[model samples]
Target: MSSDLFYALTGASLFTLGLYALIKHAHILRKILAINVMGSGVFLLLVALAAGGQQAFDPVPHAMVITGIVVAISATALALALMLRLREASGLAVLPDTSPEELSEQLPEAPSDVASKNNGKNA
Candidate 1:
């Protein structure tokens, strides 16, 4: 097969794999990583397609890829920071596949909750 075809297929495969991982995983970090993988696949496909054209080399796709890389890095940093905050607040990284109420019940009681309960008993 041609190199362009090979690269395109690889890009498609990567996108599919990333989609599957994004659906199958429960961890927030894993979801973030899957998103990154999907972005990479799209970037690869764009570059491959641009290179495969039968005309003068185009710089648009390359510029887009570079811009996408910068955006991806920023997005990743934001996602990781959100995950860190979630971990600190809940001590959990994986998402719950249940109702919001049930998820809330699963988390540990806060200091405020304990203090309120003690005050109620003493008062």
Candidate 2:
């Protein structure tokens, strides 16, 4: 088999695995990793397609892959930042809405005299 064929097969396999990872994993970090894997697979395919064997490798596809990699990293960084913010806001890193209403429940009723005294002080 030609080197191009081998590279193409490898790229396809990587892309397939990445797709599986994205679908099977529920964690945001895992999804991010899967997306990066998919991006690498695409970059590999671009390079393989651009390889002309004898004449010359195409510079256009190479430049495009480089730019795409930069964009992918930027997107991943933004996604991670959002994930961190979400974790901070909710106090959980998992995907489910597990926040309990009991955690935010109101305190038990205070004595009526204490309440009246507090109200009078505020007034």
Q: Pick the candidate with the highest lDDT.
A: 1
lDDT of each: 0.83, 0.75
Look at candidate 1 and give me any clashing residue pairs: none
Q: Which runs of model 1 end up more than 4 angstroms from their true locations? A: 100-123
Summarize candidate 2's per-residue lDDT along 21-69 as a digit string, tens digits.
8888867888899999998988888788678364676789889999999
Per-residue alpha-carbon lDDT of candidate 1 for residues 3-47, written as tens digits (9 for 90 to 100) = 877797788889999999999999999999999999999988888
TM-score of each model, in listed order: 0.78, 0.73
Give the Å shift of residue 114 in candidate 2: 31
**What is the clash tally of candidate 1?**
0
Give the runs in model 2 whose Cα sits over 4 Å from its true position: 52-54, 96-123
Model 1 scores worst on lDDT over the 10 consecutive residues at 110-119
What's model 2's TM-score? Answer: 0.73
True lDDT of residue 26, candidate 1: 90
RMSD value for candidate 1: 5.0
